[model samples]
Target: MDPLILGALVAVATIAVLFSGVSVATGLLIVSGLFLVLFEGMWALELMPDKFFGKLNSFALLSIPMFIIMGSAISSTRAGADLYEALERWLTRVPGGLVMSNLGACALFSAMSGSSPATCAAIGKMGIPEMRKRGYPEEVAAGSIAAGGTLGILIPPSVTMIVYGIATETSIGRLFLAGVLPGLMLVGLFMVWSVYSTWRNTGLSVMSARSYSLREKLEILPRVIPFLLVIVGVLYAMYGGIATPSETAAVGALLCLLMAIVIYRMWSPKSLWVVLRDSTRESVMILFIIGAAGVFSYMLSSLFITQSIAMWISDLDVNRWVLLGAVNVFLLIAGFFLPPVAVILMAAPILLPIILAADFDPYWFAVILTINMEIGLISPPVGLNLYVISSIAPDIKLKTILKGSMPYVGCMVLAIVILCVFPGIATWLPDLVMGPVR
Candidate 1:
């Protein structure tokens, strides 16, 4: 069979299997296995073990579980709840203050968590109910938190970035540094939109049930100082040359554990077991998917499909900007159905060559792709973050959550445009701190 035809068959089969509700790891494994047998025969099976270990044996990827443990440990505490309560106390007097608080909390939590659904679920569980109690619109409350939660993947220490860096052979530290500005930019954009939306419509504002004095407001910091310390400590360790990204994650996890046990006094044997179990489960799921994706990626390279696609696109002689725009649009559409990691793993092999051929900075393109995938987390059909928020606030229908996320989707698109026009927004911090990767 022609390699292109084989590629098309694999793509269609994978999509069909995924739509049939198979897990991504399962679908990719099944599809890749069948194609390998059909095309390459039994001898290729000999390579599977090496491939699995190769994918799992990354020092940098070790951070996924450590960061996950950190996030889970913190989730077990009152950290998220206290952080939001403090924000509410301070911001309730401002327009769309509660919504802003929700976005702020999500960004702060994203800095710690590195997982979209985790951030969405943790913040949404606290923010949505309180927003409802304060007479805030359900759609606004749900939408903003869902959208804000997508920040988890774009920010530094992001699991998605870790995966992308390892897959692309980019410097993981540089990738982490590169994401900082764009992540903060998205946070500002989301918050600005929230405030503007509330201001134009006075109906969105609600009087606080009680007010806080300066002393009380200042005291709120103690409740959240531990989390802030973890974020700062992790970033400083990585950027200040004290630790690798993976080591920073381990240290951060340890800090989060100590904070949960010593400071918050929320850690018990049972709770620690639960956090470890949940972190293990999530880490295993991600690694399994990456292992499966490694098989599919190997098959693509063997078939020369990635190189073929890149050559075909280059031969079209299309303007590079037009090609770039089209790639973004394709990724945006694909995001609605595929999770970000799947999209990155599946698409990067094919797309990155064409991007590099166009003379685009790999690091900048990574940030752009991260932003696009983040939008997908809240998009419908397979919007994981939307489902997470819905599960947390059972009263808010999925459709309402989906509807609410659209405006923030616009904010993401605008951020993409800004990044495109000024690549420095994504590249500057990394360039200043670590120098360029490419």
Candidate 2:
């Protein structure tokens, strides 16, 4: 069989299985396995080496489990509720203040958790009800939570960044550092949009002026300060060369455990057990997907599809900007149908070559690709964030969530454009902090 035909068949089969409601992991694994057997014959079985399993046994990948454990421990301990309570006391005085606070809390939680679903589940539970009780529209409340949840992947210690770094062999520390400025930029954009949207509606009420004495505000900081410390500590260690990215994750995880146990006193053996078990489960799922993706990527490389695509892309008589735009459009369409991880897995292999061939900055392209995937999280038909929000508020129509998410989506597009035009915005911090890329 022509390798290209085989590649197309594998792609179609994966999608067909996904649409048929089979588990994504199972679908990916089965499709890859079948392709190997069918295309490569019996020798394909023999070619499945021990090193394939060994690839998952990386010390760097250890960060995934540690971060997941930390996230679960934090989520299970009701730490998010404390953070929100502390934030609400301070921010609730402004118009749509609670929503702003929700974004703020989500940003903090995203730094800690690094998973969108966990962020959504943690913050949405509290934010949605509070917004509704405060007379905010359901669409606005749900949209804020869903959009805010996306911060998880953009912030440092992000699992997505870690995965990207690992897959591409880019510096994980640099990738983490790269995310900070862009992440904060997105947060600011979301806040501005949230404020503007609430202002335009006029149906929502702002908090009445209730003075909090200096002492009261000071009191809340004690609760909030620890979260900030954890983030700062991790970044400081990484930036100062005190620890590698994996080591920073370990230290951060230990601090998270201590915060939950000693400071909050929410840790029990049972709770700790649950956190470990849940983290293990989630980590296994991620690793499996990654492993299967590795296999598929290997198969694609074996078939020369990546080379073919890169060659074809290079042959096109287009300027760099046009090529970048084409890549964005392709990723956007992929996002509508594929999970972010899958999109990253499939597209990164093909596109990275094209990017390198075109002399594009890898870090800039990574940020651009990440932002595109983030937008996909809110896009129609299959936006993961939309489904997450819908699951929380079943009565709220998907259309409302779609409409509400548009502003944030627009904000994301604007951010992407800024990064494209001013690659320095994404690259400057990384270069300054990481020093000139070798």
Candidate 3:
């Protein structure tokens, strides 16, 4: 079969299987095995073990589990609650501050967790109920937290960015550094929308139930500030050449667990079990997808489909920006149905060469792709964050959550436009710190 036609068929089949409710890892594995047998012959099966171990055997990949463990530790405790409570105490006097606190907490928690669902569950469970109690609209409370949670994959320690670095053979540290500004930019954008929406609706501020004294506010910081410092230290370690991501993740995970234990009294056996169990489940899920994607990538390359597609796109007589817009549309569609990590694993490889061919910086494109994934988290049919929020705040109907989330979705789209206009927002930090991708 012609490689182009075969590639098209494989893509359609993969999509069909995934949308048919097959697990992503299983769908990719089944597709890879069937194709290898029919085309490469059954002997290809012999090489599968090496492929699995080869992809699974990365030291950098070890960071995924460590970071998951870090996120899960705090998430399984009152740390998220403490973080939001502190923010609420400080921001309560400001208009729309309750919503602001959720977005802010989500961003900070995301910096620690690096998993969108984890971020949402950790922050949303506390943030949403409190927002409702303070009289913020269900949409504002649910929408902002859901949107803020998407920041996990765009922030430092992001599993999605790590996966991208691994797939494209780019520097994971640089990728982590690159995401910093764009992630903050999204948070700021989301905050702006939250404030404006709240102001427009009623100017009815969601103040704290009672005023907080200076001492009261100061006390909350001891619990929250250490976690913030841990985030800063981990970022510094990666950027300042103090540690590899895996090393930073290991230390960060240990510190977060210790904090949860001492600060929140989460050292009990069941509490420890929840942290480890969640870490294992989520880590296994992501790593399994990575392994399967490796085989899928190998099959595409071996069959010449990857080359054929890149060649075809290179032959186009269109403007590079136009080509970029087309790629964004493709990503938007893919992200609408697939989880961000899976989307990154499958599409980032296919898109990287084309992006580089169009004179785009890989790191800048990482931000753009991550923002697309953010849109996916709030979108329906397969919006994992949507489901997460639903489970967290079941009283808020899905439609209400979707309605609240749409404006933040618009903010993400605007953030993408802003980054496109000034690509430096994504590239400047990494370039200055790392001395330009070299």
Candidate 4:
């Protein structure tokens, strides 16, 4: 069978599986296995190289599990709750203050955990209840958290960045650094939007301006310091070349465990067991999707599909910026139905080559790609963050989640345009901090 036909068939099968309500990992594995059988023939296994699995065995890949463990440990501990309290106390004095604080805390927590669901779960638990107690509307509480949770991917130490770097062979450390300004920018955008929206809606009441005394503000510092330490420690180790990304993750995980057990004293035997169990389950799910993506990507490469697609795209007469806009449109559409990781795995292989062939800066292109994926997280019909928030706040209809997310989605779009116009926003910091990539 022609590999192109086989590739299309695989693509179609993947879409079918995705819509079938089957797990994506299972879908990917099934499709990959089918491709292997159809293209390689049943007895052609010996012709396949061992290198397929080798791609999955990177030290960088180890970061995924360590980061997962770190996120789980932090979420399971009382540290997340404490951090939220500190943020609430500090920000509650402003208009729409609690929501702004939620966004800020989500951004900070995102730097620590690097996973969206973890960010949502940790902060949503605290932010939602507090917002409700403060007489904020349920929609406002749920919407802010659902939208803010996406900062996890844009912020540094982001697992998504690690996955993106691994997929594209870009510098993971530099990618991590690149996210800082944009992440904060997005947080600021969200805060602005929250304030604006709250102003428009008279139903939402602002918290009274209660000033925190120096002692009270100082008291919250103890809770804030641990998270600060974790962030500093991880970034210092990675940027200083004292540790590779995976090693930084391992250290971060250990630090989180220590904070949980020694400082927070939440690491009861049962709690530890539960954390390990959840981590294992999440890790297995992620690894399986990655492994299956590896297989599918391999088959795509074997068919020269990426090269063909790149050539076809490059041959177009349109301006390069126009072409990039088109690429963003493509990714946005893909994000509506595809998971962010799946979008990266499937599109990066094809798109990176095209961007490079066009002589676009790799770092700039990476930031662009990252922003597009972030938008996907909030897109309707199938945005994972939306579902996570909806599940947590079940009373809020999907339509409400979709409606509430529009302003943040617009913010992300504006962010993408900013990065597009000023590539320096993404590239300059990495060069300044890490020196120019060789």
Top-scoring candidate (TM-score): 3
Using lDDT as the yardstick, the better of models 1 and 4 is 1
lDDT of 2 at 210: 58
lDDT of each: 0.85, 0.80, 0.88, 0.78
Give candidate 2 misplaced runs (Cα > 4 Å): 1-5, 49-51, 203-205
Model 4: worst 10 consecutive residues (lDDT sum)? 43-52
Candidate 4 per-residue C-alpha lDDT over 292-327 given as tens digits, one digit per residue, 9 for 90 to 100: 677767767766665666777888888988888899
TM-score of 2: 0.94
**lDDT of candidate 2 over 1-438, digit per residue (tens):** 665566677778878988898766667767766777776786775554542575586789988888888777787767787777778778878777888889999899877877787777778888888887776776678888888888887788788888887778788888877877888999999988887777677545554545677678778777668867888898899889898777888888888888888767865798778878988998898887778777767767766766766777799999988998899999988888777777786678678878888888887788888888888888877888888888877877889988888888889999999898777877889999878887
Off by over 4 Å in 3: 205-209
lDDT of 3 by residue, 1-438 (tens): 998899999998898888788899999988888888889898998877678768888888989999888888877777778888999888888777788888989998887777788789888888888778878888888899889988988888888888898888899988888888998889999998888887777576555456789999999899888888988899888888898999999999999999889888885898899889989998999999999999888888878999999999999999999999999999998889888889999998999999999999999999899899889989987788888999989988999999999999899889989999999988998889889766
Q: Which of the predicted structures, 2 or 4, would earn the higher lDDT when compared with the native?
A: 2
Shift in Å, residue 60, candidate 1: 1.6
Candidate 1 residue lDDT tens string, 1-438? 666777788788888998998999888888877877778898888887688678888888888899899888888777877888888889877767888889989988876777677788778888888887877777788999999888888887788888888778788888888898999999999988876665565565564557778988899898798789888888898889998888999999988998899878865789889999999999998899889888889888887777777778899878999999999999999898988888888888788889999999888999999999988888877788888998999988888888888989999999999998999998898889987664
Ranking by lDDT: 3, 1, 2, 4
Residue pairs of candidate 4 with colliding backbone atoms: none
Q: Judged by lDDT relative to the true structure, which candidate is superior, 2 or 3?
A: 3
lDDT of 2: 0.80
